[model samples]
Target: MNITAIKDKYERPILSLRITVTNRCNENCLYCHHDGMITSEDEMNADEIYRICKIAKNIGVQKIRLSGGEPLLRKDIVEIVNKIASLNFKDISITSNGTLLEKYAKDLKDAGLNRVNISLDTLNPETYKKITTKNLANSAKRGVLKAIEVGLYPVKINMVLMKGINENEVKDMFEFCKKNRIILQLIELMNSENCDDEKFSKEYHYNLDSISEKLLNICDDVKTRDFMQNRKKYFIDGGEIEIVKPIDNSDFCANCTRLRITPDGKIKPCLLRNDNLVELISYIRKNESDEKLKEIFIKGINKREPYTI
Candidate 1:
């Protein structure tokens, strides 16, 4: 099969596919956006997910990211990873809250997972419980270590900066990531209607400008990733940090190359909007041809647009 890269009308080539394996999560964080997906129990099985990924690979999407309310919650996660890995994607990763990494990281790695991104907002147990409404900080921390030990290279930690909360813990979190040789991603609290709470964003959205300026002065080097919303990665004293400022950023939207699949199996064109989803699983359930699935994929790609712009 000749891989032909698909592009939207905005000329952004689709290079990455993000699939939400399930909406069920163990933690209820204050800033959980649920990946802009409605709660659904009808998640696609491993075989169905494999079919979607196979079609995606045929269309030249080199990267596949498994996400969830918590992707590790799925019992068949290892099987899912094994199936996707067989497609031979350039990258296969997952975004998890990290409480289950200690138990599953080794199996996932052995199944061909390239890396992982774990969410750890604060190292302080009290604050972690306050934010996530769960006292599993120790479990999450251990998961991080286990992932590193299992040889998941470049294990990234996602810390969403929140004002009057964990914002002051930046230096502490960076130190931990540095000690673990992990990449730290400082994410700005997203201001979206799809979030768990609208007032939560208004109350906690910490401006990253001040933080970015500080890192700019001390950084040893800087590199821009064009495919990933042109976000800047900073290297400081043998430690690495990446700033993810997705709120109200035109450049972030302009350079996005990701196509999302909701837990219930719809192609989501934009992360911040729920109106333009193209139904996909219905045809797949109907046992449609691969060419028919390809047409549905193209239809969803045509609907792609920058939410911020």
Candidate 2:
């Protein structure tokens, strides 16, 4: 995190960090949920996140995101966000399912949250029920609206578009984004270790090339949101849409800038790959010097390898 000589093997400097706060999600979207996890839900408490955020801010990690099974599910999220905000962070955001956001958006905003991203893959009620095994369409929709109401400008909707599923909503999502001034992010479904089960079918491949072609037709423009570099903010157009292709094995994986921290205190260097982590107490108790902690951050950064086809 320190900007000095802390360069990855590829020489890329780390900046943005994504932190997951909880593991218990309300809805288990069939495809994305995994069977393997320490379900006990044991991790750092509010005080721990506060201390970590303080350490992160001291070093040069300005942007921190709260993620999880659904960060809002944690009753202490508001306090956590408030504490993180009280740090030296330049941006504080949270990723949630939106089912619980409607009830907490105002409180979250009051806690110094700058933005929020909700996981909403389908708009059709039937498809939603089929996908999530629950009828949360109304409440989820309300959550998005509530986020918008609180001036969470450019409220982002993280839509994991899959073929034969919610892919057709591409155009509809852009139209919705244009009208509501929301940022609709059409992200390709990832190929995880557990992706091949009944949940992830071949019909869901959804080649980015084809999807982008069709999306360009609907979107007035599509912009790639760069991490770390702030050359551009939200991509603006008659219809602003962002396309994020999956990167399990892609050429530019070496430059992947974002880091994810799972709810149970497991820090994933990259979403596609399982790697090293920072055990909170162990790391602190070791009396690890600032430079060594920066090394831990850099070790993950250096692990970044080139992606293959």
Candidate 3:
């Protein structure tokens, strides 16, 4: 197995990588950096994404995550997934908004997709509309059902808690996830990108303490796990909820293991600090060598600066 030493001090080995296949999306979630839409004219082609995935696999990256503004929007998404699975990766999963996922859930699972992370911020129809600025809850619900039926184990539900937005829907969302036997994660809104900055304020900021207290009311026992440095997972009423502080806060992120790949093949080492990205495929095609490709993957991992020295 190949391994690379990241820039951080001696710690755990880097093993997971998140690849964003497309900048395009079908919905406009109020909390995302790009309004859940494509801002760039250029996006990564299917082959280009696979190229990166292949290189990562050779270098002992056991887990691969497919993300995007919404990955399911790509017409050739299934092919991309098949190609990644062909690499024999230990895990292959996708993070989608669940609107377009309904149509492909079964196909994806059959094509080697191990699981899915569906971003459902609210369960209330009106709240859903307010958050996504669209009428698409039905599509999301259907996607969840289809994903489970297709055997997307640990079918995780990513719920973002927004103040004055949909905080009231937390319990209902938990019930929906629990009834469906899915993992429900509650995320604190992080004003990371430009669009998020535009809406950044105390009002938009929902504190974790208040959220934690309320979770205890319903959960038989409130428990948290410091999986990584700043990450803490809350288990309420036998439902899994994760609390993520804004990524921008330096102290909150220490176990910076997974790398983020934008839709256009830009490699982001850290989600909060939008810097130090290496273009792997375009450069690979120009020079084209396994050694060169592997080098890029190592460089991306080594650039970790969780606790910069």
Q: Estimate each model's TM-score.
A: 0.98, 0.86, 0.89
* Better candidate number, 1 or 3, judged by lDDT: 1
**Which candidate wins on TM-score?**
1
Ranking by TM-score: 1, 3, 2
In model 1, which runs have C-alpha deviations exceeding 4 angstroms?
Answer: 196-198
Q: Write the residue-wise lDDT of candidate 1 on 26-101 in tens digits.
A: 9999888888787899999999999999999988899999999999999999999999999999999999999999
Q: What's the TM for model 2?
A: 0.86
lDDT of candidate 2 over 162-263, digit per residue (tens)? 778887787777667777878777676666664464446466756656766665665455454455222112344555566666665342465556665555
Count steric clashes of candidate 1.
0
lDDT score for residue 51 of model 2: 63
Predicted model with the maximum lDDT: 1
lDDT of each: 0.93, 0.69, 0.75
Residue ranges of candidate 2 with Cα displaced over 4 Å: 1-5, 33-40, 197-201, 217-222, 228-237, 249-252, 285-295, 307-309
Tell me how far the alpha carbon of residue 278 in candidate 3 is from the true structure, in angstroms, after superposition.
Answer: 2.0
- Give the RMSD in angstroms, all C-alphas superposed, for model 2: 3.4
Q: Is candidate 1 or candidate 3 better by TM-score?
A: 1
